[model samples]
Target: MTHTFEPEANKPGTQAGPIPEAAQETLPVVYQDEHLVVINKPTGLLVHRSPIDRHETRFAVQLLRDQLGQHVYPVHRLDKPTSGLLVFALNGDVARALSEKFNDKTIKKQYLALCRGYMPSQRLDYALSVKLDRIADKHKQQDKAAQPAITDFTTLATCELPYAVDRYPVSRYSLVLCEPHTGRKHQIRRHLKHAGHPIIGDAKHGKSVHNRFFANTFQADHLLLSAVGLDFSHPVTGTRLTLNCAAAPKFIQAIKRIDWQEPDWAVAIAPKWLAHG
Candidate 1:
């Protein structure tokens, strides 16, 4: 493995701003500088095109590049159904530096999710098979061994909704904070499923009954997963930067149904980024 990291210097006279609520309809800039630009990617938007979905024309890479009037290099990828902070480098050198950080597991990320069943706080230790693509990895080993994957989960709250979502009359759920130790494709979602508490609205690895329940009841057509916070050293400045973004409105509505103290949850446990807003 190579370990070369050097970020490009920023040019003066260019200004970047955070994503405002009004701009949520489009790609919202969470943080931006001359070297790097971060966006709050909405659910259902691909980070880039993949053989998994060949028909997608509007992707984060294309949308952000056009939105900013410049080319952007994607440092990492978030699943199309996942929403949260996405980082893009204005240039290639910076992109390489940031990508190295992600590979080395130096970039800290926290995700918020609603799960199907009541789960206590626990560390999920498991491995996942690499999800191969139809076109890209067609020749790769179809029966390749599983790769190491781990995730830490803490239950922030739990509740029983008055709806028959499963075999039971009342549906059970938990709001969990998921921190993945690896960046394997669909790591968090897959790990949670292996632990028998799949994320709500995860159509592929989740329970279809609960997914339909959320869709019909809450109008939640996408995964109820959000990258709520990220902490990493800036590629250019080397400053430790912490950023956080709230989940989609429908997620909050589901949380409210659990009777979790939303305001207390924010003030006591949320990062300063959300508090500052």
Candidate 2:
């Protein structure tokens, strides 16, 4: 995780996304204690500033720090366009402890996504090339072999739109549950694209025609990918913890437009642990 303490030199929070400055307090907290703070991050907000997106000024770390009036350490990252549960540590020690869990693959994560075309319940065990940011990893990174990536997916619902999309008379979509076995940058989005069912509203690794259709019809300009649930054992107490976050409003809106029934995996309006964070 990267953070700049140069508050006087630059004001990150002052620059804004579509989310109003007043709505910053409304950011949902999913889990919290002396050691950890987990939040339901909104779409288009960066996990932290990156050289890849120099113009982006709104970030989760900055918002949370200002909201809590203290320093919070990022334990893991959720892509800027992806929303849902994100965890942060209260201090460096806790951050290291939690980061170890993520590195070891002991942390289990589940994501909900809306995709184009039909996808059956199957495990996608595919290899993906390294996706580098033009600014961040441009010349410093080595050209390595494709990494192994696996995502277990189950189709929860399907929709066939009346309008002709591309070649087909009717557009097909699916509500997919994704559990990625490996953590790579854009793993889920790229894997879904490779499987021929790229996520809806994904400007990257997705079909532009389908993306424009969602923007025109459903008013969804953000990617339809959400981290719905996370499970891990606490580093201090060693107790098993299960944290779930509800999907973004636009995601729910898009699913509803397709008449998708809420599957068991979809989280509720409020999970029990929300108030604590």
Candidate 3:
């Protein structure tokens, strides 16, 4: 069954009218089956409720559950500001199985990110300390050491704008395709930042000047990172499934404004696993 939901307004914390064109549209369902369903979650929508974003009314889980008229179990999540493919299991058993696949590194995830500097193709083998939330992980141990985090990335496209968003006369950027071998929280963003090519629109780790430039120039105000693809064996069917979707409209518009050609993997669905193979 096809499902849709009205996205949250562009301006956060307000639910009234005058929603942006993208916000007014329905949530795009990428793939679905008897055991599972996946949706192209728009930027700004929470995967579920949390104390961190207590004021937000709209959530992907609630919307998807209401739209599908069944309880859906979220196997994984995307950051609230990150947009694209999200998976949900129809039953608890499948959820556990899929969760195990993610825990065991059996499932592959591909992400597209627009970063501030031109990044080269490389593998980042860095470790990241656990980022605990004040409200959520307050009771947990705080002195845990950094865990291993690795990401394989390629610079798919690059462009230089004439405007000096930073100290340089010309602002440089790259479109990156990243496959994370480990699911560390914010692994791709942190790894890219460590490489000195932080993804645009990353508030915590990116340069504010370049972020403001994109917001004013292209009207793209959200994070430029998106989970574009997920490849895994279906929990019940035991068949390989490669699910893909394009980035959010604002993200694509920013890429076009920079005159970078969108790679086929960015917009087209792949029939087989193509990253980190």
Q: Which candidate is the best by TM-score?
A: 3
Model 3, residue 217: distance off in Å is 0.3
Candidate with more favorable, higher lDDT: 2 or 3 = 3
lDDT against the true structure, per candidate, is 0.78, 0.79, 0.81
Residue pairs with colliding backbones in model 2 are none
- TM-score of predicted model 1? 0.85
What does candidate 2's lDDT look like per residue over 1-277, in tens digits?
Answer: 2111111222223334464564355356767778898888888889988988888877888788766657889999999899888999999999999999998899989898999988888998999888776678878566878999889998877777888878889898998889998998899999888889999988979999998898889988889998888888988888788887767778777766665444543353223222221
Q: Rank the candidates by TM-score, best first.
A: 3, 2, 1
**Model 2, TM vs. native:** 0.85
TM-score, structure 3 vs. true:
0.86
lDDT of 1 by residue, 27-134 (tens): 766678799987777788889878878888768887676567688999998988898888899999999999999999998898989887887789887888889987
Clashing pairs in 1: 19-29
Top candidate by lDDT: 3
For residue 140, what is the lDDT in candidate 3? 96
| Candidate 2, residue 82: how far the Cα is off, in Å | 0.5
